[model samples]
Every structure is written in C-alpha cells, then in structure tokens.
Target chain A: MKSRFKTGIVAAVAAAGLLLSGCGPAATGAGGETLTFMFRGGADEKAAYTKAIGEFEKANDVKVNMIVTTPDDYSTKLKAAIAGKKVPDVFYVDPGSVQAYVKTGVVKNISEFVEGSDSIDLDNIWQYGVDSYRFDGKLMGQGDIYALPKDVGPFSFGYNKTMFDEAGIPLPSADTPYTFDEFVDVAKKLTKDTNADGKLDQWGTGLNVQWNLQPFVWSNGADWLNQDRSKVTVDTPEFAESLQWFADLQNVAKVTPSVGEAQTLDTYQRWMQGQIGFFPVGPWDVSTYEKLPFEWDLIPYPAGSTGKSATWTGTLGIAVSNSSKAPEKAVELAKFLSANETAQQSLVDAGVQIPNLIDMSDQWVKDSTTKPANKQEFLDIVKDYGRGLPANSTYSAEWYDELFKNIQPVLDGKKTAAQYLKEAQPKMQKYLDQANQAAGIG
Target chain B: MSTITRRSTLHRKEQRVALIFVALPVIGFAVFTIFPLLFSVYASFTEWNGISAPVFTGLANFQAMMVDPYFWQAMWNTLFLMIGIPIGLSLSLLLALALNRKMRGTTFFRTVYYVPVISSIAAVAILWQWAFNGDFGLINQALAMIGIDGPNWLANTATVKPAIIIMSVWKGMGYSMLLYLAALQSVPRHLYEAASLDGAGVLQQFRNVTLPMLRPVTFFLVVTSIIGGSQIFIEINIMTPGGGPEFASASIVWYIWQKAFNYLQMGYATSMSLVLGLIVFAVTAIQFRLNRRNQFSID
Candidate 1:
C-alpha cells in the first residue's frame, strides 16, 4: 500500500510538470502581441491618457499595457527595465534625455515611419517640437526624428487677480512687459500682512531657481553656454548680475518668503492658498488650479537687460523603444498619442497640455471652459521667444544639477554670485567638454 | 549484516530527498544574489554606462574616489547618522525595562511603540517633514510656546543631520525595544532576587543583574543598528532631495544611487559600492572579534 501511494505521488508530480511545460509558451505567445506604453504624470494627466488609450485599444483591437510612474521614479524605473531587457514598447521621452537615450541606441528613429504615414501631418505640428527630437547622427535638433512632442510647456507667470484687487494694484497687460526693477516694485506692493500680525502672511512672488530662473538669465542677455555650445558663458558679469537680482528678491528685498519660510509651505501651496501674488505657472497646472478660491491669469515674464521676455519651454515626447517586438505598432501608437488631433484635443480640453499642433493652438486657447483669462500668452511665448534649456547634450544633466546644487549657498546669501559662478564655471565646463566628446560633438 | 544494509539504503534515500528539497532555493540564491555580487565586483574595475559596453579601466574609478570631495562628504554624513544608534539603543532599553514589569496595559504600550516600525517609510518621512518645517511645524510651535525660537530643522545645513538623526531614533527604537523585551523575559529571576537580598536598590539591581544578563542582546542590537544606520537613503531622499541645502544630509548610499542612476556612471557607482561593502564588513568583523574576546554567553 505504501509502494502504491509513492507511485501515485510520482505520477501526479510528472503530470503537473508536463502541464506547466505546456502553459509557458502558450502564455507568452498570446501576450507577446500586446504593446506596452509607459508614462509619467500626476492624476489628471493619467486620467486623460487612460481615456485616450482606451479609445486606441478599442479602435485597433490591440491590447496595450499602460504603466504610470511618478516623475521622480520614472527615469530610475525605465533604466532598470532597459537593463533587465524588458524595455517597454513606447515610453515618454524628454528633451533633456533625448541625446543620452539616442546615443545609447535605446530610442528608435521613427523618421521612416513618419515619412511613410499619410495620417500624420508634420506640417501642422510646431517645428520647434519636431526639432527637439531630431538628431543628425551626432548632433541633436538636425537629424532623424526619434520622437514626437506630446505637449509644449511654456513657462509664464500666473498672477492672482483677487490678490491684486485686494492690494489695489492693477493687473499687468500681457503685451506690455515690466522691467525687472518695475516688476520688483509691483511685487513689494503686493506683499502684505493682512491680519496686522507681526509676521507677514502674504508674499509678493516666488521663484523656482531650477525652473523659472532660466527666463531671467536669458532675458538679461546672458546664456549658460555660448552660441556654439562649446564654452560655458555663465561666468559673464551679466549672468551674475541677473542671478543676484533674482536671489535678492528673497534675501535682500524681503518680499518673497525666506528659504526657511518657503520650506514650511512651498510657493505652489502658498499660491494655491491665495497667499502668493505671483508664481510661475505651466500649462500642466491649469487643471489643478481651476478650483482655486482666487482668480488667476497668465502674463509674460518680466523683461530684463535684453528688453525682451525670454521664457523657457519644455517638451515631452513619445518615442518607440529599440527593443520593441512590435515596432510598427508602437510607432502607430506614438503618432496616435502625439500627432492625432482628436487625442491631442482631449489633453488640451483637460487643461493638462498646450496644443503641439500648429494652428490648433487657437482651439486650446479658445476653450472658454478653462480658467486663466490670458491663454493666448502661452502661444505667444512659444511662437516668439520659447527656448530650450542649455544642457541639451548627452551626459549633461549631472553637470546642470551640480550648478544648481552648488548655487544654493549663493541664493542663501552665504556666497556672492560672482564668487560662486567663478568657482562653478570650470567644473561645469569640464562636464560639458566630456559630454561633447562622448556624443562626438565639437 | 542484512540489518546494516537496510539502514544504509534508508540513509541514502533520505539524503536524496534532502538534496531535491534544497536544490530550488540554492539555485535561486546563485541566480539572484551570488551572480549579481560577482558581476558588480567585475564591473567595478571597468568603465561602463548602463547602456554601452564596459571598457577596461583598471583602478581609474578607485583613483577618482581618492580626490572626490563629495564621496568624502557622503562618508562623513553616514558617520554622523550613526551617532543616533547609541542614543536610540539606550532609550529603547529604558523603555523595555519599564515595560517588562508585570503591569497593566504593558501589551498596549508595546503595540503603540511598535507601530512606527511597521508603518511605511514614505508615509513616515512625509509626517516627519511636516513636523520639521521651520515656520509652522509642531516642533517650532512647541518651542515658541516656551519662548524659544526653533531653527529651520530641515533647510539649515547646521541642523539637518540632527533632525534626520532624531527621526531615525524615533522610527527605529521600537525594534530594539522588542528585542530587549525578549531578552529581559529570559533573564533568570533568581539573579535579581539575590541582588535584592544583598540589600541592593532597584537601580543597583538593574545595573548588576539586568544589564549584565542583557549584554548579548545589547551587543547584537549595537552591531545591527550600526550596519543599518550607516546605509540610510530613503529618509534623506524624501526629506532633502539633492542633498538638502548644500549636500548636508547626503549619505554614502544616496551618493552611490545618484551616480549609478542620475549620472549613469555604473562603473564608478559599483566601485563605491564595493568600498562601502568592505567598510561594513570590516566594522562587523571587529565587532564580532570584540564580542568573542569578551566571551558573553549568547545562548
């Protein structure tokens, strides 16, 4: 009886092993045909993408595995996935990451796909958006297009109209720009202590040095790199002066919150709570800020020494991965996400993104359902003065981050701007030179 | 002779069954742990980004480490974080001693203390970030009530490390307390009774009886906490990203992660990892040696 029981157990185990062997290939074969799409965004952005992706899946009769990650964890997770040889079929690509990703041969050049597709209207899309992903073998912005822009994020100022009214200050016109000095004066007036407390409860303006500070640096007629991108230009006196002026808004002018005060409630939170007069607003925040108790409107950044309001524009693009099994289908999905007017309109209506398609931006601006009275200002900046960041080369993010990291001491009034820039220039130049060499650029 | 043959056959069958049972896990260890360790050691000697082929560059990464000020700063920050371990261990021990007595609601107190250990690190970090805020934080508000101004706990370079240490101690004390509680339960009751009969006070009895009896548990806690404290990453990452006001709170593991992922300097990151691993191994070895020399009864 014991021998019979042992035989029964062995037979049962063999049958189970045979069943598992049969299941493995069948499972993979069925799922291998489905495409995977990965992106990074907050809740509203996710909801918009979910609606669009659902439409695409239903129309194409193809399954898509959507993966959403936070902006902080996206790069780490993507790199790990690539290293593990489980690269997603399509993924979000940023302008800063384009060169590095392309150099590593992870991103596919979809120019052939773009050229052949009759459905995609390249002429309708903004040229700057197209140029952002173009790589000419060695240099970016000139060659084959690796991705298509999902949205154009033009950085502009969003001012609380309710605060302006309460402060008895008239709203600034979108076309008429304020000089840096005049802007600071307006900010000083807007700052107040409403309840007559010893502490000031409201701030004039807030500046995120990492993001919004670029406009001031550019409008001051100072550049991070020279025209050719060969040498660091941040050591110039103009750059130092511009940076000092912006830093002084908090440290010297005493209008904005101190670094310590800002830590308690970030400028964004303060702005949402109707405590900040002005803050840099991107199109992505339109959906989030719609429910604010105060009225807000967009305006151009204040002009500086250059006599022009030069703003920084960022782009998020969709690209097919090189390791994708379904490259053709992935490119189709990328085009659907980025180029198709129907899909783009959904995102624009949701107030999460500005139109990437030219002429179609009027539709985005005319969407009366959205808040922000001066939506036209976003398009004006993008069309006239929007510029990408200076750190566009491969392996340059570290160097760019280093500049900001080391400059915190200067912003805190511990070091002079001139002194910090002089010390940081050589290190930044070294990184730029190495990155140029790595990317085979001069 | 026939009985001996039967016994040998049964022993061989038992051995075969044991091998079959252990094979799966041994294979998993080799694939997941051993293979990566060996590969990382090899990669440490080469120059490779995650995407490209690694180039042979002997000692270059190690040479770079010698002059890297950031690496040294990270090490210093890691050491600074370890200062909390001793303070944490002592506090936990006191709590364990108080709770170990047969008192009402001891289990309730134990559960309350253990809650933070089981809570998610991200959640705990967000809670602590709010508490450490300079202007409106609970800590600063409390300080203000007593006519003392609180420094910007997280934003100031001078106070950031201390703030991190305080949070670390609060979050980790529960684990140590439980361990000490277990050790206290096993302590022979007669040892304390004898000390009492000798006219010793409660404090003297604790020092003479409880502490010496709990030495092994203390030693274990010390060694493990040091190893754990020196590798703090999540707290710094969440509270003070980009090293928090001039890289004041960046630990060695945080630096390693930045190099590997942010900079794509995989080879350099691996080299740093190997060095960190060696440092941990050396410290643990010294602790074991000291423990052996003292000859504390672990069992």
Candidate 2:
C-alpha cells in the first residue's frame, strides 16, 4: 500500500510539471529571470521575436517570452488586460492610441529610466518620434526613452509598372508628379473593357472607401474636425470639393470601381493581384508588394491645390503597463527594445520599416530594396514635409468614426459632398463639445 | 437515545448540509451576475470614462437618446427583424410537418437539416456574405444565368436590410423547425385519424387537429423568437459592419457597442441598453397576451 501511494505522488508531480512548463511559466535561465514583450504583428512575426529573445537571453542571462497580437484588436485587449490588473511588462503603443492609454494611468511614465542612461542614446531619436510619446513635456516613457519609433508607415499613391508600360505613359518623375487633372485623365484612359462585355475589365484606381481617406482631405489643407479638434469640419468648401472629386472618380470620371464591384475583393487584395492601379498606401505596401507577383512602383501623391504634397504619419512606440509587477525591469526591457542599435537593425533586416531614430533611418533608406520603386522618396517626404492629425486625448476615435460614417454616403453618391458636410458638422460638434467638456479643455 | 430527539437532530443536520451546498453557487451568482447588472443600472445615470470617477447626470442620457437619430434608426432596424420572426416560425412549422413522416432516409435528412442549428451564426453569416457578393457571388451568378440582373446585395442601402433578413431566416430556420418537429411527434396519431374520419380534407384536418395540438409549442417559439430577434447583434456586427452600406442595417446592440467602446460614451450606452431591455420586455408581454387570446387549444 505504501509503494502504491509513493507511485501516485510521483505521477501527480510529473503531471503538474508538464502542465506548468507547457504554457503557464516559461523556462527560466540561470538567473531565473523572465521578461514579457507584447508586440502587434503575430503569426510569422513571433519567429523573429523568438530569435531576438534568444540573443537577448544569451547576452544577459534572462529569458524573454513574447506575445504578439494583430493590430486590429490589440488596443481593446491591452485596455482590458490593464483593467484586470494583469498588464504585460512591455507593449507597442501607436500614436493614435497613445493619448488614450496615457489618460488611463495604466501606462507608466518612463522619464527617470532615461535621464542619464548611456545604454541607450536619445539624441539620435527624431523630434516627432519623441513628441509622439511626450505627455505634458515629461516623457511618459520614464526618464529613459520609453519608445523608439522603429518605423514610419508614410502614405503615398502606388501604380502597377506593367499597367503603365501597357498604357505607353512615361513613368512619373520627381519633377512632374501627375497634375490633378492629368491624374484624372490617366485614370480614365487606363480604365477600359477589354472583352466585348459592357462591364469594365480594369479599374484605374481604388477609392478604398474606408477609414483611411483622411489624408486626401488633409492634402487639400482641410480636415474632418476643426483646428482645436473641437468641431466637425466636413462641411467646408475644401472638404466638399474633395468629396466631389472622390465620388466623381467613380460616377463622373468612371475611373474607379463602384463599391459593389470593389466588394469582389478588398482593395489591397485587388491591387496585389494586379487588377487595379494607383492605390494610396503606406511604405508597408512596398514590403507587402515585394511578396506579390506584380511589379509596382510608388509616386508621391500629386500636389494638392495648395501646392504642397501631403502624407499621413503613423508612429509605433513602446509603453510600460502600470500594473507590471517589476516596473523598473519592464522599463529596462522597453528601453532596450526601443533604442538599442542592434535591436533596431534586427527589426529592419526582417523588414525595411523606418526606424524612429533619425540616424538609423539613413541606413534603412540606403538599404531599401524598393528601388526604381523608390521607398526612400516617401520616407524623405515624411522626414521633411509630413504632419499628423492633432491627437486629442478625448475624442480621437469618435471623431474618426463620425468622419467615416458621414462621408460614406458621399462616397456612394447618395448625397453631394456639400450636403454631407453640412449635415455632418453640427452632429460632430455635439460629440466634440461633450468630449472637450469631459477633458476640461474649454 | 429518545426517538423524538434523534429525529429532530437528523432533520437539522440535513438542513445544514443543504445550506452549505447552496452557499457557494448563491455567492457566485451574486458576484458575477446580479452585482454587475445592478452596477450597470447605476452607471447608466452617471458619466464615467472607464478610468475616472463617475459624476451624476440625472436623466441627461435618456434625454439625449430621445433625440439621437441613430438611436431611432437602430430601433427601426431591430423592429424589422422582430417582424421577420413570425414569417420564420410559420415556414419552420411547414417544414417540420413535411419532415414528420415515415420515409426512407428520414433520420439522415433530419440530421442534415439540423446541421446549421449547431454551426455558429458568424460562420453562417460569412458564408451568406460570399453568397451575396455582387460580382462573383453565387446568387448573382444564378440570377445572371436566369437573365435577371441582381441588385448589389450588401452595398446597396435598399437591399442590405432585406439581404440580412433573408440570411437570418436561413441561419435560424433549422432550430425552430426542430422544436416544431418535436412538438409534432408528441401529437397522437389517433387524433389525425379521427379528424379524417369526420369528413375533413388534408387542409381541414391540419387546421382542426394539428394546429390545435401544437399551440403550446407555438407559444414557446413565438415568445422565444421575439426575445431573440429583439437582441439581434451578431449578424449586423459580422456581415453589415458600418451599419449596413448607409445606416440601413444598424441594430440596437451594435449601436450600444459603438457608443460604449468606439465612442467611449459608457453612460449613454448603458441608458440605451436599459431602454432596449424595457422595449423587449413590453413587446414580450404584449405577445404573451395576444397568444393567449388566439390560442387554438383554448378555443
């Protein structure tokens, strides 16, 4: 009986060990240290991160467990994790969401961690990158630089080189980016029915009737909300004219596919398959297009009537969760991940994303494989000329949602652009007013 | 021991054990369900932005909800689905009658029809979306073959709500049919035979006999369908995101989700949810009253 009892205890111990080691607790190194890293890109991304952690572990006698999430639902999940007091040690914070996360007190301020650290250099970081994470001028990233902008997704218009060749148009040059009228004319000529069928076989461009069209409005020196981010500006003459031009691409010019036809596949999927030309996208598309069979090239968006080229800016940064058990250790990991030259190079080699460090971006620009396609041209624009929407802490997401909903009718040709703007602004003003009041920003 | 004392002691011990067993579950319910519901009710009257302290706002939320056009649009969309519940029930009843027979492969057919009942609504909605796609969708292809041009199923505002209603019926038909099938089985075969001998035709026999027999099941299905339809959130979320092409397909639950998570109007969202719950409660009460008056079994 004693022998049987001993055997049972041994079996139970073995079972517990298997369960605990599998998912609950990561294997410990010699120092028995574990660091958690949360990032946006999951799937194949975890492999690169796992390798990085292996290098970090061998160098520092610390084990790192990385949890990667898709960008779409990560913010909502991160917020929930913080609310439940189970925040990850380190996570990515996009500029769009940084304001909201900062207000919640769930993310730690990292000013002290960076005050005099020689381990990471802050001088090499870009001003915009630094400012993206700055709250009340006390770098929210602890005294140490919390986040290093590893890459910028700078928006531009792309076209299929094969389609340009077939159409017999000279490739767009820096001196003469297609004029607005010329751009429309080119799209019209490119859009045609090859088969005797009445339906057009090729679309010249994709409007991408989604949340990302704000750049077009901004390019015209107009925006969805007013300067203070307090009221909707959709009804302005510039916004209305922009909408008309957007809709006319489908209804009047017949250069773009209607929403119905566009639904056959998403605009990106269609562009990747070489069915459409001239889509507005970020530098990430260069990486995306590298995997596609089609040969595509990028062009700076045509100068708006204001005679200035415009692009949208999205910055990704590092943030420490307030509920972290070891805030100091977490800040260290965040600093290493954000500002380390070796770490940044490792991320760049995996993909040619723009690093937040201004000095590192020069190397990235030189190393870019998107040549003849010229990925550097877009990065140059972001460095020299680009500006982002004002990131208001109170109603950024709501304002964006409202702008999209109100413009959808205009895109579909159900309402004229002027009519849509007129109807949308007052309603938007109500939301902005409430948000401003809540934020104490009267 | 004295007999009376022993009996009393045993009774007390049994009661103590019962209370001990019930204690854990009662506490669990109070902590998880009852407390949250009460907290939400309190939250509906205040302004709280997830992290901050909530301030009292009285009936401000309700007052605003009364004027919000989107709130009314969502209510209208919900009512559209609520109206479809009866159409779905009657069709299921017909299908259940046809299937309730001694035919070859009857069990196989029954299982096949019951397949969708087990599959998730999201998976079914996605399938319907592909089927409804305008250019390459199977429905459009079929219509093209028949020389009839189909309208854009999801993109066109006029057709989106109808498309959703049709998809909802397709997704929901199997479960109600199974319920009616079970109810049909419980009716005695002798009653049908008696009705037939009394010189009634097939339709007459069904009207006089089967209809009356299935009243209880009908009442169950109608009440449940009303409750379910009034809370339709998933189909709108998955298929008709952005509230259908032009706000034509927005439902109350989807609007509540937008207000709370997207807009960060937590107090307003709570008030909207409470109002929706009250609307459902009133509708169900009215439905129960109408069902009682029209019940075939009572007549």
Q: What is candidate 2's lDDT per residue for A56-100, written digit by digit as tens?
A: 667766667687777757766766665555667788876655555
After superposition, candidate 2 runs with Cα above 4 Å error: A1-39, A54-67, A137-151, A196-198, A264-266, A340-352, A356-360, A368-372, A389-394, B292-299
Residue A95, model 1: lDDT of 79
**Model 1, range A1-442, lDDT digits (tens) per residue?**
4764575556556545643553342122253368899999887678777888888888776788889999999999998888866778899988777877888899999999986578688888887888889887666778899999888888888889999988889888788778999899999998888899787889898777888778898999998887667788889999999899988988988789877776525777888999998898888888888889989998888889988999877888898999887788899899988876677777777778888888788776787767887988888877788888777644457767778876778878878898999999988887788667656675
TM-score, chain A, per candidate? 0.90, 0.83
lDDT of 2 by residue, B200-239 (tens): 8999988888888888888888888888888888888878
Task: Determine the iRMS, in angstroms, of model 1.
Answer: 4.9
> TM-score of model 1 relative to the true fold?
0.93
Please state the i-RMS of candidate 2. Answer: 7.6
lDDT score, candidate 1, position A269:
84
Q: Please state how well chain A of candidate 1 matches the true chain A, as a TM-score.
A: 0.90
